[model samples]
Target chain A: MHEASIAASLIEIVIDTAEKNKAEKVTKVFVKIGRLAAIEIDSLEFAYDAIKEEYEIIKDSEIIIEDVPITGKCQKCGVTDTYEEMFFACGACGAFEVELLTGEELTITEIEVD
Target chain B: MGMVDVKAKILEKNYSKAAVLRDKFKNTCVLNFVSSPGSGKTSILEKVLVMFKDKYKLAVVEGDQQTTNDADRIEATGVTAYQVNTGRACHLEATDVEKAMAELGYDLDLLIIENVGNLVCPSQFDLGEDAKVIVLSTTEGDDKPIKYPVMFRVGSSFIINKTDLLPYVEFDVDKCIGYAKGVNPELEVFQASCKTGEGLEEIAAYIEGMIAKKKNA
Candidate 1:
C-alpha cells in the first residue's frame, strides 16, 4: 500500500538524476534499501511496475532495489557489527544499549539513462 | 559497459525537503499524533481544539487515504484543516506534509498532523514533528507497546485515551505503562476520554505548555 507512494518518489528521483546527466529517458535506477528500512522489497517492486506506467520516461525502466543489511554498534565493548534483524544488541559485548549504525537507508544512488 | 558505484541515500531527497520544512516550523510547534483506528484521535482533537482554539493558532493536516471526514471535523471545531489523501498510502511522508503546510499557511502557532490510523508506519516516518504522540485507547489490548515496542519507544508522549470507557473494557493500564516505560523510560503517558473529556485537560495542558514554552523561549 505505502510502496506505491514510495515508488512514485523513486520515479521522480530517478528521472531527475537521468535528466541532470543529460539523458532523455531512464534505463535503470539503482537504490540501496536497508534490511530494516521498514519497506518491503517485493511490494516496492510491484509498486514500481504499477506506478512507472504513469510516467512515460520510466514506463519501461527497471528498478533495481538492493537490500542493505542492518548493522549495529555495541556501546559497552565498542564492537560494531551488522545483523539481519533490527536488534542492536551486541553479539561480542552482550550489551543491549547499542546504537544503530546503519540499515535505515532508502535512497536512490544511480540512474542509467539514454 | 559495466556497473559503477552510485551509492546515495534514496530517502535523502525527501529528507532534504523535510529538513527545510522543519526549519520553517521552528516558530510553530508541531505534533504528529499516531494511533490505531478507533483510538479517538479525531474526537480527542475536536475536544482539545474547542478548549484551546482562542489561545492557540492551531492548524491540522488530516492524512487519510480516501475521505476528508477528519479535516471536516477539524474545521467544524473552528480550526483550519487541510486534507492530504495518500490514495492508498499508509503513512504521511515528508513531501505529502510539505504540500499541506504550504496550502494551510503559516500563521498557526501549532500544527497537528493526524496521521493515517495505523500504529506501525506513521511512527517510522518523521514529518518534521516537534514530538510524536501515540493515542492508546482502553478498547485495544493493553499489551500494545510490548507487541509494538517500536511505536511506543519512538513516541515522546503516550495518550491513554478512552479512559471513560475503562469500566466497559478490560484494559490493563499498568501493563501498558510498564512496557512503554521499559522501552523508553522518558515517555510521558496520559489517560483521557474524548467522550467524557475526562483526562483531556491534562493532555491539552501538556500541549499548551509545550507550545507556550517554545514561543516564550
Candidate 2:
C-alpha cells in the first residue's frame, strides 16, 4: 500500500535535492525506514523504477532502504527496549502492554549526488 | 554515474497537512466517528440528530467510499449534511474534509464525519479532528482492542454499541474495558444501543457537554 506512495515521493525528493545541489544526475538514494513504517521495500523499488523512467536524473538511480528497529516502553516495569513487530513485548517484564517509541521513522538517511 | 543518496519519508506531505488540520480543530472541537461496516454509526447519528437538531446548529459530513447512504439518512433529520465519497481511498483525508467544509455552504456549530468502515487506514490519516470516537459492537467481540491496538490506542473515546443483544451474544464488558485501559488509561468508554435506546442519553449528554465546552472556549 505504501510502496507506491513512498516510491513516488522518493523520486520527487531526490530530484528536488539534486537540483538544489546543482547536480546533473542522482546515482544512489539511501533511505532509512523504521520497522513500523508500514512500507513494502520490493514494491517500492518497482514503483521507483516505473516513476524514475521519466526522470532523466534518476533513470539509473539505486535505492538502498535500511530498516530501523522499534523501541517500546513497558507500563508494568518501566523498561525501555527495542524489538521487531513479531517480538513487540516488554523484554524486561514480559508484558504485552507497551508504549511504542521511535520505531515509526521514514527518513532520508543520506544523499549522494555528483 | 553520479550518485545521490536521498533519505526522506514519502508520507511527509500527508502527515504534515494532517498536523495543520489538527491545530485548526483544537479551536472548534470536532468529533470524528469510526467503526466497522455494520456497527450502527449512521443510525446513532440519526437518533442524536432527532433529539438535538433543534437545540443546536449542526452540519454533518458523511464519508463513504462509494455511496451517499448515510448522508441521505441525516438529511431527513432536517439538517444539511454533506456526503463525501472518497472514491477508491479507504479513509477520509484532511484535504477531503477541507473540501467538504466548503461544500457545506453555511454556518455550523457541530460537524461530524463518519469515516469509512476501517480500523487501520483511517486511524493513520488525520482529518483535523479534536476528538475521535470509535464504535464497536457486542457482535464484534471483546477482543477487538487486542486485535486492533492501533485504533484503540489512537481513539479518544469508545462507543460499545448493540447492548440489546447482550443475551444473544458473548461480550464481556469488563474485559473490553480492561484491555482498552491497559493500552490507554485515559480513554473514555461508553456503552449504548441505537436499537433499544438504552444508554443513549449518556452519549448525547457527552456530545452536548463537548459542544458547550468548545463554544465557551
Candidate 3:
C-alpha cells in the first residue's frame, strides 16, 4: 500500500524534526489527511505502527490523524459545499467548474515530544 | 512533553526528490503512463514510441513487479529501455526514477515511464513526469473514472484504448469521458486502438506537442 510509503516519509520527518528540536523522544505525531487524498486511515496507522518500531525516538509514539472532508467552492455560482462523492459538480449551479477548497491535504501539522 | 510544530507534507521527501528531477528533466519531456493491469500501456508505447524513435532521442523506464517483458518489447522497437523490477512495491517512487536515470543516462529528448500496472498507488507517487497519461481500455467499466477519481484528477491526458472493441463491449465512450470530465474538466481525452491503429496519430501528435513545448521552455 502507498500508505506504507507515506508512513515512512512521515517517520522521516518526525525524526528529523525531533532531532532538530533536541527532543529525547517523540510521543505523538499529528497529521491531517483529506478525503480526496485517497488514503485509508487504518492502513496508514497500521503502517505507522509497523514502521515506527525501527526508530527508537518514535517507537512509543502514537499517531493522531484528522480526516478532512472534501469541500469545494463553485467557480460559477460561488456556493460552497461538502462533496461526499468524487464528482465536483456544483451543488447550486450544477457546474463542473467547482474549485476545490480542501480535502487534498496530506500534511503533518505538529508532533508531541519529550 | 512539548509539541513541535512541523507543518510539513508527509511525502515531502519524495516531493523534494521529484522537484530535483523536474529541474534535471527541463529539456526532457517525461511522461508517466499509468493504468490497471493489461490496460495496454506497453502496447500503446510499443506502437506510438516507434513513430518518434528515429526522429528523437528516446528512452523508456518500465516498472513491473518482476518481469523484463515490457522492457524487452520496448527495446525491440529500437529504443533504449530500462526495466525497474520493483520487487514487492506496487508503484514506482521518484527514487526509482532517479536510479533508472542513473543507468539510462540523461541525454534524452523524451523519457517515457511505463508505471507499474496500477491506478491507485501510482497516482500518489510523483516520478517527475511532465504529465501522467492514464490509459483505460474498453473492457474496463466506463465508470472506472469515478471509481478511481484520484487518478483521473491527477492525470493530464486520458486514453480510452481498445476502441476497436467498442462495438462488441458495453463501454460507453461518451459516458466515460463525461465522468472523467466531471472529476477533471481539463483532461485532454483521446480514443485509441493499437490493433487497428485507430486514433494513434493524434496521440503521437499530442506527445510530440509536449516534447516541443518542453524543448521551447
Candidate 4:
C-alpha cells in the first residue's frame, strides 16, 4: 500500500534528476533494495509502473531492482558476515551483539537518460 | 544514452520532512507508540494523559486507517488529540504529524503520536518522534520481539502492557525482556498495567524527566 508512496517519490527523484541532467528521456533507473528493507519487490515494481506513466520523462523507463543481502559485523569478534534476519548471530563467535552493516538499504544507484 | 549516476535514497523526501518535523519537536519530548491492534495502547495512553496532565501540557496525534474512535477517547480524557486518518496507509508520515501538530497549536511540553496499530510499516516510517515506544501486551505472547525484529529494533522503549493479566496469562516476563533485549540492547523496558495503574507512575516520571531534560538543554 505504501509502495505507491515510495514509487511516487522515486518518480519525483528520477524526473528531477533527469531534468537537471538536461535529458529528454530516461531509459532506466537502478534501485538497490536490501533483504531486510521489508519491501516487496514485485509490489514496488507494480507501483513504479503505475506511477511512471504519469511522468513523461520516465514513462518509458525500466526500473532495475538489485537485492542486497544482509551483512553484519560482530561486536566482539570483529568478524563481518552475511546472515539471515532470524539467524543474526555471528557465524564466528555466535554472539547476538552483531551490528548491521548492510541489508537495510533502499537507494537509487543510477539512471540512464538520452 | 548516457548513464547518470544518481546515488540517492528513494525515501529521501519523507526523511527530509521527518527531519524538519524532528527540528520542530526538538524542545518537546515526542513519543510514538507502535503496537498490535489489541495491545492496550489507547487504554495506556488514557491513563498516561491523566497521570501527566498537571505536570506538562500534552497533545496526542492518533493515526488510524478509519474512524475517530481513538481521538474521541483521548478527548474524553480532556487532552487535545488530533486524528490523522491515513486511509489505506499503515503508518503516519511526518507530514501527517506536522499538520496535526499545527492544528494542535504550539503550547505543549509533550506530543505523543499513537501510530496505526501495525508494527511492520510504522517501524519503517519516522514521524519525527524522539522515541519509538512499542507496546506489547502479555496476551500477545513473549516471542513478539524476536518474531518482529524490525519493530523491536526501531523501538527505543518497550512498554509491556496489561501486566495485571500476567497471573491469568502464560506470558513469561523474563523471556519477553530477554527477547526484546536481544533485538534492541538499549531498549528501556517498562512493566505497566493500565487497569491497576501498576507502573504508570514510573512511565510518567520517566517521560517527565525526559521532557525536563530536553527543556533544560
Docking class of 2: acceptable
Local accuracy of candidate 1 as per-residue lDDT tens digits, B27-110: 898899999988989999999878888987889999988989999998998989999998867899898988997788777799
Chain A: TM-score in each model: 0.89, 0.83, 0.98, 0.93
Question: How well is each residue in A54-108 modelled by candidate 1, as lDDT tens digits?
Answer: 8887788888888887677777888888765344447887666667777667787
TM-score of each candidate structure, all chains considered together: 0.81, 0.82, 0.98, 0.94
Q: Model 3: per-residue lDDT, tens digit, B1-217?
A: 9998999988888888999999999999999999999999999999998887799999999999998999999999898999999999999999999999999888899999999998898988888999999999999999999999999999999999999999999999999999999999999999999999998999999999999999999
lDDT of 4 at A93: 84
Candidate 4: Cα lDDT at B106: 59
The top-ranked prediction according to TM-score is 3
TM-score of the B chain in each candidate versus the native B chain:
0.94, 0.91, 0.99, 0.96
**Cα lDDT for residue B183, candidate 2:** 53
Model 2 lDDT tens row, B1-217: 4554544565566667767766655545578999878898988888876778798778888888898888889998887889999887677878788888777733566778899888766766667777889999999999887667667767888989999998999999999887776555668999999888987888888888888898787
Report the lDDT of model 2 for residue B59.
82
Off-target runs (Cα >4 Å) in candidate 3 are: none
What DockQ, between 0 and 1, does each candidate earn? 0.31, 0.40, 0.88, 0.64
Q: What is the C-alpha lDDT profile of model 3 across A2-100, one tens digit per residue?
A: 898889889999999999999999999999999888799999999999999999999999999999999999999899999999888898889999899
- Write candidate 4's Cα lDDT for A1-112 as tens digits: 5677788888889999999999999999999988766678999999999988888888899999999988889999999998775446689987778899888888999999
Q: Superposing every Cα of model 4 onto the true structure, what RMSD results?
A: 1.7
DockQ of 3: 0.88
Rank the candidate models, highest DockQ first.
3, 4, 2, 1
Worst 10 residues of 1 chain B by lDDT: B1-10
Q: What is the lDDT of residue B133 in candidate 2?
A: 91
Compare candidates 1 and 3 on DockQ and give the better one.
Answer: 3
